[model samples]
Target: MEFKDYYKILAIDEKANASVIKASYRKLARKYHPDVSKEENAEAQFKEVGEAYAVLKDPEKRAEYDLLRAQGTYRSAGGSYQPPPDWQSSHAGNRTHSQRTDENFSDFFDSIFGAHGSDFRQAEDFQRSTNRRGRDLHYKIALFLEEAFVGCQRQIALRVSEPDQNGSIKQRDKTLNVKIPAGVTEGQHIRLTGQGELGIGGGKAGDLLLEIEFAPHPYFTVDGMNILLTLPVTCWEAALGSTVEVPTLRGKVKLKIPQAANSGNKLRIKGKGLISKGGEISGDQIVTLQVSLPKERSSEAKALYRQLAECESHFNPRQAFER
Candidate 1:
């Protein structure tokens, strides 16, 4: 695994606060969203960004990461600092020994952090006394909006490393059958017991925390549990109240537009948003109205517009701005 510079990826100062880290993550995530970005290796870059954020976003992890980085404790293949005999034994007692290994990191990260391996025996010993379960591993799984509305099952592949008979570490692939419950919201986590890193000694294995992320829909954006959609309506539809068919995560629904409704008006559909886990709590869908004008106007249309203009000659739309 290569060393990762979390501050560099976020383009923030070392003293950046949690809010700054969160803002940076949002900006970077939007830019590298797989559905929209065409950048080379965008997916890889995005993953790297996520990893960086995952560490920096948490105060405890960030502090530990900063300490290790400052100590120059990491040893890369070509680094001048060499570990002493049984270096693992020296730091074996450190709580962050496993984290320092960076085994889960990429080669690029390993190059920076230095290639280190965890001492399974030491970890096992530590667990024998504490009897504490291992920390849960978190992963983000992206789904479509429809999938959020209708539950689905997904087969997920995970890579794990284990010690071989010779004590060398080997990578293994594990497939998990995950059931996505309906009404699952983005940022929510599903816990799978004994699916994370194995516990040391006889302790219980860690739980796998799978965070939900929704794919960007072409027509809608989600906020909290509410769904937002910018629906284009004809001028007549806005001037004359009409019931229009609108698309939702479930299906098409009829929405009533009040007469004289203007562009940018928002209409709410109650209990039409994402359902809660227990199928009891619900949210709303907000539809923003947009009035589209005809690109090409007929002669009669121009005449009618001129006639309307004569009646509204005194109306100065920009008067407020001028004042």
Candidate 2:
């Protein structure tokens, strides 16, 4: 079997401190976790990361691995992998660290640290008495801004660890219809109780926290609970105020632009952005007006533009810079 470089897999330097290693592991785990990640081959990548962390986190295991690497028993990323003599002769670690990689770990790792090796009895005995509370799960879900304005239900499948019939915790998949509440903003969390890992020794199951993120909209921008929209208008429409139809989450509404409105002019429509659960207006939608000029004009229009330019020739737009 080809050797696995735990350091390279974790994206950490060989001499990375424990804290840095842990941070890198957590970040990668979140990215590749099967429940939340839609990335290509995420499940496989997640398993690789887990195996790497399993070996690297333990100092004793790391020391043995370092020795194998130094003695040419192991390999680096994409390097030729060859075992040193007497690999299974019990000179290296003897399965001292037992964190559930027995069957899943690659043959390369198993050769260096034999499965159920010399000191396996102590680790097994220690595991018998270790009962841990269910671990809480964190995940992120994306929604359109309109969905945040109007509450929606989503069927999401969660991958969790639960107690099996054999009394051992194993990965289990569960699907839930989650109700996303209205006014849920970006980075806000929705907690689902009793939806996490199965309890040990009859302990209560932990909770699952779902974080909300908004998908990018083509014509809208978000600020807190408020929505911003840019309305493109003709130069004449901006100079001479016009009533225009503006788009909102609910529907299009009529907005009156004041005469002589310049670019970047913002008009607020109260109670038109989002609504809170208490039936209160969360925020208003702000429309920024942008005046646009036609690129081409007919002969009559060009003549009219020339006349208009002559009429306003005395007005110097660069008056601010004249100072």
Candidate 3:
């Protein structure tokens, strides 16, 4: 039989304490457990890990195995090992046969520590607790800004893992209609209770954490609960007061532009922005004013502009440069 290095199997140092050995076993068991792991050959790997833990967890079995390793009695001749004649475990008198037949330990394990080598009951106890809960699942829901502003219901299709009658995990199609509440910010999570992977061994099912992501919008930008919009206005409209229609989350609304409003001026419309989830607080929509000049001007319009330029000739807007 090939020599099975228990320490190498567990990926631990030879001087590892009992706690480190148990910790490594638990981590590997969870990673390779057939029920939840997506790893290839998970069942075979899990069995190997369990067999390694079984031997290392027992004090008497570990001591006997260590002595055999230290003595180098087994050699790899033609990829096979033969034990020395009259080889016997000093702790064999204290060895107790385990009733665990579920685990098919390797022939190498039986050669060193007899047929029922280590106390598999302890390993089983750890495995049972480590695999009790199902793994939590995360799903991202991409929403438009309007959908997040106002609550909406979305139907999503997912393939979830569930245990069958024979205690084997199977993938089943699941559909869920999730109600997204209003005022959800980016990176927010909406949890669905018991909607994730089914628990192992009758334990409680894991929760599905729905992460909220917003799709890019062409007309608007979001800042926390506030919404920003850029409104274009003619030079006359900015020079003189006017009421213009502007787009908001709800719909288009009229906004009054103050006289002498310059480009980059901001107008605040209260309560027109995104609402809070609690409905107790409301955000304001901020409109930035951009004065747009006509690309093609008529002769009469050019003459009027020249007349206005003559009227404001003394008003040097760049007077600060004279200092």
Task: Provide the global lDDT of candidate 1 against the true structure.
Answer: 0.71
Scored by Cα lDDT, where does model 2 land? 0.75
TM-score order of candidates, top first: 3, 2, 1
lDDT of 3 at 195: 91
Poorest lDDT segment (10 consecutive residues) of candidate 1:
119-128
Q: Give a tens-digit lDDT track for model 3, residues 1-323.
A: 78878899889999999999988887777667786677788888887888888888888778878888887756655767666668786644545555325455676766666555335555567678866766788999999989998889999888888766434567999899999998887789999999988887445789989999988889788877788888899999999889999989999999999999999999999998888788877888989999999999999999999999999899988899999
Order the numbered candidates by lDDT, best leading: 3, 2, 1
- lDDT by residue (1-323, candidate 2, tens digit) is 78788899999999998999877776676566555456788767766776677677778778878877777644545675767665553434435455435545566666767654433444333222333457898888889988988889988888988654334446878888899988788888898998878655335678989999989999998887788999999989898899999999999999999999999999999888766676664789999988998898899999999999999999897999989
Say which candidate scores most in lDDT: 3
Q: Highest TM-score among the candidates is held by which one?
A: 3
Q: What is the lDDT of every predicted structure here? A: 0.71, 0.75, 0.81
lDDT (Cα, 0-100) at 32 in candidate 2: 64
> What does the lDDT read for residue 97 in candidate 3?
56
* lDDT (Cα, tens digit) per residue for candidate 1, span 1-323: 34567899878999998899877765665455344355677666665666677567656556666766786655656654433333332223443534553323455433323333443233223323433354577788999988888889998988765333322336778789999998899999999989986543224668889999999899999988899999999888898889999999878999999998889999999988989888888888999999989999999999998998898799886899996
- Candidate 3 at residue 139, lDDT? 93
User: Which residue pairs in model 1 clash with each other?
Assistant: 1-109, 1-110, 2-108, 2-109, 2-110, 2-111, 3-109, 3-112, 3-113, 75-114
